[model samples]
Target: MRPQLRLLCDSSFRGPQRSRDVASILREVDELQAKEIVLVAQDLASYGKDRPDELGAGSIVDLVRQVSAKVPRTRLLYLYPSDLSDALIEAILDSGVPYFDLSLQHVSKPHLRRMRRWGDGERFLRRIADIRARAAQATFRSNFIVGYPGETEDDHDQLLSFVGEASLDWCGFFEYSPEEGTYALGLPDQVPVGLMHERIAELREMQDAITAAKRDELIDQTLEVLVDEPGIARSHHEAPQIDGIIRVPLTLPTGSFASVQIVDAQGPDLVAQGADSAS
Candidate 1:
């Protein structure tokens, strides 16, 4: 697996020279045969904070086009967020980028605030709705933290509720792992490991149900799958090289797209049925 080189420069209103600078850098990469490129927007507003209105969506579309035109074989991953307003998420989807990475950590609002992460579950849901509205065929993914300090049974249950509501195309469930230097580490009445593990199991179970429903929902939906190497067919939720894949019945042609249908769900992987293939 090749490491994805990400350009994190905040595109907020820095002006034309900035755009040119970015263009120049991309132009250099145009000459080199890079494996993959991911443009990550750390925050919503910051992604397009700089530049003129004309530079808004067109600029991103142009940038991605430039890269692809330069290196015809390069794959681009646009990491946007549903945490932003629906309009913004829609704009991102309308930018002609085929991939989007959203976020959702611990469906419980209280736990989210406690973690000092994005709040507004309703808005998050709305943004997801917007994504589906704009591009029903788009590939989407999100994350969730299982346990948090002071997270009660009610909170965990609330999170479970959200799992069903979100119907995330891809879901990542992580057990709360505390870091000593962080504020969560200093918070009182930390959840016990045993309890945390219990909660993690519960959350995973809920996520499994939600994921199954999502997979089932897409059973008849046509999806353009990027074929993988022999014995490896990855899910939409899995990050490249970081997640395991479903075993495909037949070897698949690398880098080619094949139409597939969701047939089964296995933890993080969605076993897809396509024209005999594996990646």
Candidate 2:
């Protein structure tokens, strides 16, 4: 049996037809008996924003509640967008899933403006703190683009500072790539490719250390993890495929949930022993 099933419901999941479409899909998957159902979307919080659902479930919070009620047996998860409003953040917290995959390109306000995004470093930090305050075990992941057009030394420093302060569970730093017909292509002061590489390397190193430190904190803690395969599993703190995985005994069955105690931290990944074997 497959460990989990992922449904890619992008921006197309909108308008009055959304409810019927979702119902149909859920009905079809009900027989699969998958361990987890991950609803992958660009901005799940923005669901039904432009067009309200015909059934009166007009927000992501409503959608999640509906799905949970329908699929009470399977675990549900979704991806988050970068531009999260206060209402959306509250909705996410209420859903009882503390994992956040914020697609924030950059935290520097000036740089974000250049990228046509929102939120500054300070604002992002405050929001993150609020989430943690509400859910101590909450996990956060975000991506940043290094060396955007007109990116200054101060902007890069601000990003570094934010990474240290935020202490996100997962982070991805990519060098800026110019695409055809994009606004960045016409922008002046494009950073050199070599400098972009250097900047990304710095970000990667700093974030790697932070991620390792955070994972180390989980050592000895008993967690209920879902085994994806014979030797790989993950708790809510780690997303499937994208984030680090937990190494379990080969005897563990795939697509099964087991209680494990984290035994060691291997940088980003972790080593865990079954609760029965843990000392």
Candidate 1: regions farther than 4 A off: 1-21, 28-36, 40-98, 216-222, 230-239, 242-252, 259-279
lDDT of 1 by residue, 194-245 (tens): 9878877876777677656655565555554555665455444344754435
CA deviation > 4 Å runs, candidate 2 = 1-8, 11-20, 28-31, 53-58, 70-96, 274-279
Best by TM-score: 2
lDDT of 2 by residue, 110-144 (tens): 88998888778888788888888878888899888
**Candidate 1, residue 17: lDDT:** 24
In model 1, pairs of residues that clash are 12-49, 12-50, 13-49, 13-50, 13-51, 14-50, 228-279, 229-279, 232-279
What's the lDDT of the predicted structure labeled candidate 1?
0.57
Predictions in order: lDDT: 0.57, 0.73
Per-model tally of clashing residue pairs? 9, 0
| Per-candidate RMSD, Å | 5.8, 4.0
